[model samples]
Target: MEDTDFIVNYVKSKLITINLEILIAKDGEDGVRKGQIERPNLIIADLMLPKMDGFEVCQQINSNPKTKDTRIIIMSTRNSKENVLRCYKLGIDDYLIKPFGLDDFEQRITRLLYS
Candidate 1:
């Protein structure tokens, strides 16, 4: 997951115990680098990231043959239809609006990882 400290910590506390290897990125560029290096099964990003931003990150990941199959979940407060469409255009697997509860987050992750 590539986001600020708050979201990273929140997800870590909620999901780390479940054996998910949570990776933290402070911004979009870092996230992309880590995604390329780690090749994690899934990536959760926020739209308003420092540097490149989530859309660009998703585009890069999807475009790369190595990471094309990696599922992307964008989490952000910007839930406007336009933003959602933009993310879809970039080939995001799913999205979640900010302030999501633990159950909802867990369910989404589980569905993506297991389905």
Candidate 2:
């Protein structure tokens, strides 16, 4: 399965118990546009995206006053310490490595949304 597909399904499964809207973006640019248009309460992004990288997407969202408050969760295969640190510096609310378990995903999402 593709990365976006996997992420969408995973998020859906975890959020099934709650009522929320899910938007799927094919790449970073789309994600940014959707973020601006939808003004979603939260965003989950992958590091390596088409068109623009996730870092750029996050940077744009964070820089914009309209979307700056949107909680961002970075989910990616890149688990290098530097990458993780960079995400934090960029103001991401949370970071999850790829191949994470459903329980962890749910917990993180819960913490982000509720806390």
Ten contiguous residues minimizing lDDT sum, candidate 2: 1-10
lDDT digits (tens) for residues 2-98 of candidate 1: 4578778888887786789877887888988888999999999989889989999999999998899999999999999999999999999898998
Task: For residues 1-115, write the lDDT of model 2, one tens digit per residue.
Answer: 1147766787777767676677878788889999999999999888888888878988999999999999999988899999999999999999889889888887888888987
Indicate the worst ten consecutive residues by lDDT in candidate 1. Answer: 1-10
Off by over 4 Å in 1: 1-3
lDDT of each: 0.88, 0.85
> Against the correct fold, how does model 1 do in TM-score?
0.94
Most TM-score-accurate candidate:
1
lDDT of 2 at 112: 85
Question: lDDT of candidate 2?
Answer: 0.85
